[model samples]
Target: MSTIEAHDLAAGYGRVQILHDVSLRAAAGEVTCVFGPNGCGKSTLLKAMVGAIRPWSGTVTLDGEDITSLASHETLRRGVALMPQNGGIFPELTVIENLRMGGYILKSRKDLNERIEELLDEFPRLRERRGVNAGSLSGGEQMMVAIARALLLRPQFLLFDEPSAGLSPKLVGDVLKRAAALAERGVGVVMIEQNIREAMQVADRMYVLAAGRNRFEGTPADISDDRELMHLYLGIGKREEGTT
Candidate 1:
């Protein structure tokens, strides 16, 4: 099975460091969720993994092949793609135009058109709104476009940076479900999310970061069942007293 692994990764913006010895593993057909307090370096981790930012120390591998510090476009060519925060859509571009940009790596125009149609069929609402500007769509629709754009390359692994941000509760669930669906279709999904409750519903595994370091790594049940982790890191309410 295909996999992406980051080990002992440390990165920063200029002199301010963010990630510290953070490690994660995501495999094909599974959803790995990363979450934590603001400034915990969750976004930085994604950027490093996708090559949007260079890792100061450590290694990022695709199926045991070192791919650390490769350029973002190079990473995409290696079958890993990132859907940046807010879906990373161009507001003025029509939905179809945004999808076309996603396929910029493709050399054949016919293949690009076919892939667009396939994706449009996969996302029926996008077919209906193909000509409309992406900025005017609802948050959920924009997210769909972003995800579709990332899919244009037929990536083996997809990374999402806070895909559910600023979305309604219903839309949050919808987007997470989409992530889960992608995993079901054999695309590895690594997502950074703040919507804990919604994220837990779709995540196959979870990792928590604090102060740019790993605090917890386990399944959703492991987190919910651990009172200490819940109380200290997650801030989830209703913990039983004196439970270990």
Candidate 2:
């Protein structure tokens, strides 16, 4: 298992800087949730960590080994996976074929097949629709397939960009639960999420972001005790009793 972390990370697209001195950690078997409003650099941090975009300054590490300069392919080879916001399923491909495509990095076909079997068991609906084209599935089901595909690599570090977006309430809970479960199974889980209630539900530690800089960070217990903080940033908890 690996611990993925960023130290004083400052990243952006070209000259448009977004993240500012962001330091966070996601350890194996714990969900470290990044909470923020839109345009606050939550996704930027992930892109930097996964090598999709190079960090202008600071460091990203896997087990303390610097990976900031690695390309996305090289980062994936190191057992790190990022589930994109747009579900990355080939709509024309059957569920099984789509999953096989995800395991392209695997050297052995048998190992890939075995891992697919394990995933199908965990996502039984996938087994039920193994031969169906991914395009035919609902939004929530497609998300499930995308997550299953990411698991094909057996990544030690998994990062997700709002896995619950566009999902129905039930599916939102289901997806977040599975994300937390991955952490429980020894995969370091880092998730950027706007759904505060559900995000906090599965979070072991929470980092609140505002304007691309860290605003607050602590365990869920620490956060739960701060009603003012919750109300201010996340629009949760009670506000003034007689005020609108």
Candidate 3:
């Protein structure tokens, strides 16, 4: 069964409509990448799914239950987590402190501590900088901390928005690799990314959004080979040599 599903979703900011009739589904243990040009409503869709933005019309479901109108905290409590495109970490806090904040939703201190230890072991960079302020870390390191923080909640569905933004190629690879690992461990991952190539590489399935609508849905192989589709849906024309 699908872990997260959105049906005929229409969301926007103020009176400006961003997403129109956007429908998508994310399955357990799979990475579903949503790609589009800037302002195409990819992030808006993520926000709506996580209840950060309420949909004007449609329903969002998690594990077969309708959660369309739920509050953000309620959605998080139901095992859905959103890692927004920015501002995920508390800069003044140490890495461990930031992680502790993530576990605030948990009532049992022992369970929280155990989860933190497991996450630290999984993300050694966070472990090494456990006591350092998150603001002191590089962009990539901060991203890692944000991800580790989200994992502390033991979320079943993870929503990521532009996780590769403002990072070196190496760090981008690292972040996407971690996302792939999360999907492997049975967490349904829905990622909205500007880096189409890298996102497609890690995704099991992909959706192309154009003008706030789903233009295409397929695997990486289909996206890579279809130049016309890429140009129409993603605004990515044929790449010349030595171009991004």
C-alpha RMSD values across all candidates: 1.8, 2.1, 2.4
Q: What is the C-alpha lDDT profile of model 1 across 1-244, one tens digit per residue?
A: 9999999999999899999999999999999999898899999999999899999999999999999968998999999999998989999999999999999988899999999999999999999999999999988899999999999999999999998899898888888898999999999999999888889899999999999999999999998887777767777755456453
Candidate 2 shows a clash count of: 1
Q: What is the TM-score of each candidate against the true structure?
A: 0.96, 0.93, 0.93
Pick by TM-score: 1 or 2, better one: 1
Cα distance off (Å), candidate 1, residue 131 = 1.3
The C-alpha local distance difference test score for the whole of candidate 2 amounts to: 0.89
By summed lDDT, which 10 consecutive residues of candidate 1 come out lowest? 235-244
**Candidate 1, after superposition: displacement of residue 144 in Å?**
1.2
Candidate 3 per-residue lDDT, tens place, 43-127, comes to 8999999999999999999878999999899999998999988647899999999999999989999999999999999989889
lDDT agreement with native, every candidate: 0.93, 0.89, 0.89
lDDT of 2 by residue, 81-173 (tens): 888886678999999999998898889999999999999998999999999999999998899899999998999888898888898888889
Model 2 weakest lDDT span, ten residues long: 235-244
Clashes of each: 0, 1, 0
Error of 1 at 26 (Å): 0.6
